[model samples]
Target: MATKPDIVTLEALDAFDALIDARSPSEYAEDHLPGAVSCPVLDDDQRRLVGTLYKQRGPFEARRIGGVWVARNIARHVEAWMQDKPAHWRPLVYCWRGGQRSGSFVLWLRQIGWAAAQLQGGYKAYRRWVVQQLAELPPRLAWRVLAGPTGSGKTRLLHALAAAGAQVLDLEGLARHRGSILGAWPDGQPQPSQKAFDTALVAALRRLDPARPVWVEAESRKIGLVQLPEALHQALQQAPRVQLQVPFEARLALVLQDYAWLGRDPQALARRLQALRGLQPGEVLQRWQVWARQGRLPELFADLMTRHYDPLYQRHLRADDARATMLVLPGLDEATLAQAAAQLLAGGLARVGS
Candidate 1:
């Protein structure tokens, strides 16, 4: 009395109860369905041997060998799947292209009396959909840029706006760099590839309501090693900018607070300070190095902001002729920043004339 559930497309699978990518672990790790968890039907070594057999002996022999491995794998997965399943759970399972691998899993789930569907065209099809979505995002979304000087807490403000019911796409958070030499996190994870960045941006854009403004930080076309997609870069260039201005003392305090943990590692802090060499002459660089070594972190931070960061910001501001509405926060305290951001959201400040 068992019947196969209808297969679903990637779009429909997006709304399904659970997404299961039944590819090998290595394949899932490299790239996969956006929110999918891997439940590989082939271990790494078996997958490699199967692939080799396919290339050398053709599909028939490969399938024969793969079938044996897959049968055993499915028996193991059935136990694991049962452990994961709730009585009401329905899962959309996918493999490379809704081929034998996914088909076999789908059949097994049905035999077990679970409601499961395969993804039509599978992971390859899903990737193609992601690519198409990224290619078409610019004309479909309303974007707003949050522009500010270094240490102005633009990232923090974006999160605040999101909490206040604003749609937000946090680029720096996605790229995992704060967009500066000193911006690296202490843990220092590298940013995703440019391809991955675009994929993530498109994913975020897809979730946002086009009618509501999606706030993003004003960044250079590149964030660390990753470059923004041309359409996204252009969109950012054209979006209206909300510039945040805090007092120099407040800015310095914010920077110190943000980087306080780095103070313990003077050598590392000095190396980060040294990254500013190109912006300053030999003398200024040497002076900063000495200050860094001497643990004069506050003085070092102040000089870098005034001499290097502020000037760079000024140059960009002049070049862009940006329509900036300044949100002046008296201090960088969370309470003050949150209030100022709320006022900006309420349109409560003077606009900078172009």
Candidate 2:
């Protein structure tokens, strides 16, 4: 006879052959296990309908209606999504809280002689582990902070550093954001949920060598919609720093190059400029808006830098203990960045005076 499904902790996830997520699609979109497949038993609409039924008619009626919905969806999922399962395929299943959803899925899988287990405390347990990691992980890292004005090639430099075999934890890249008011990518991809950000952050941090310095850009505590974990943010604030000093005109050129997509639509550029109104004087803001409306990107960028980005950047600099190194470059071109990366790799902290 087949036995009941075994229960497993979040720590034993690797022992299973596969991890299956049975939460609603909307829930999965927010975040899930790093490799968990979405095999939702109830889609978003069905979940809302079932929830409403439970509130009005009670759990009996809710289950009566929801049971059919869940059964139908699960059958379809097995035939279409899980048809390749081998006889010995053992999967770990989880939902929001290891409740009826995961319990029911594990029951169905076991009846067919598959070895399946429900995660104890479900995704919530995994979330707790992530929290513990964020608190503990940053301390283990040997951090080297990169700071510069808005248009400085901080992110690009991080990419170059990683490519040169340096250990790097790119928090902004993991967040899918550029870490500013215009931080959103031009193509309109949404930033990952906070949990998703943290999950990816922890994974990235674990991959780095604690013995070597982990390179990161200086960002505010919050990057776009998600905030950095408190411990990591604090570590960043106190880490030894490197400042990149690209020439003002060259920095403007770099900013235009990096954000060139924003200049494609004059009106769209104007709309973005409006965000700086409160920070800039009325006349300065008006001129900037007009410059944007006319697609005068260089002039608009210059004005924004002098009137906005430069001044605001000072606030960030004030928080730094003192920069360990200042790499002044003629520009932020590929050659300059490569040289800077080499210096970082070969010099270590002693190169600060150079």
Candidate 3:
């Protein structure tokens, strides 16, 4: 006899063989549980059709059409994604709010003799958990803010720290943005939604050890489209800092290498540059576009630093007295960065200056 499977909570995720999401395709693309697989009961068009029916015709008509779609889709999913599963294989399924879609999917799986369960409160519940984690988790761990200018390789050093077995939380990487107007990807790759960014941030924090300090960049209140949770932003502010200072020319070279994509599409680059219009003098902006047109990236980059980024850094990122350590690197090449990283890790501000 097929038995009814027990319902599970979000906390039970680890015990399940697989976590399946039964929302529409568009829903899954925005964000889902960190590892949940997409098994939409109704695809994007089907979902819209059902909603339109519910709004235009009546609940009964919508159900009649939706039920057929759900049934056929679930049948295909079980046969394709779950056919080889052992009889004892257990899976947890969820939809938007533990409603009809997940309920029906679980019922069918149970009938097939698989120990499947539906999540209580579904994706909404998981999202709540992520939000709570963000509000609480940052306070639980010590933080080390890696402070630097726009092109000081702060992101590079964070990765290096992690590779050296130090803990890291790469907020920019999580946001899919580099945290500047010029920071977006060259081909117009979009940043993550706010909720998507929160989920990713929580997942990253969960992997870290509480006893160790987390190193992060000196980001502003926001990183592109997503703002750091209020408490986490506070934590970034209060953390001890490791300040890195490099000459303007070195940073200019570094910025050029990092943003070589500007040359590929000068028009897009010019538009992004224009965004600095009010702050940059009209003559400077005109000169920037001219150099960009001529592919004079080096001079343009140098002017941007001396003219734009440098003033901003001095006003904002510079610490008056609490500099934990300072490094004036001659250059930001790999070897020099590695040496500087070693110095920071070694916990000694041995007064290195080129």
Q: Model 1: which residue pairs collide?
A: none
Q: Write the per-residue lDDT of candidate 3 for residues 1-354, one digit (tens) a residue.
A: 533446778767899999999999989988999889999999999999999999999999999999999999999998887888999999899999998989999999999998889998989999888889999999998998888787888988787777777888999888888888788855778998888888889889989899987888888988888899988999888888878777767788889988998888877778779988899889999999888878889988888888788788778854552555675677777777777667778885744434
Model 1: per-residue lDDT, tens digit, 100-168?
A: 888888888877777888988988887788778876886678887878888888888888888888888
What C-alpha lDDT values do all the predictions have?
A: 0.79, 0.85, 0.85
Pitting candidate 1 against candidate 2, the one with the higher lDDT is 2
Model 3, position 16, has a per-residue lDDT of: 91
Worst 10 residues of 2 by lDDT: 345-354
Can you list the residue pairs that collide in candidate 3? Answer: none
lDDT of 2 at 140: 80
**Candidate 3, residue 343: lDDT:** 71
Q: For each candidate, what TM-score against the reference?
A: 0.82, 0.94, 0.94
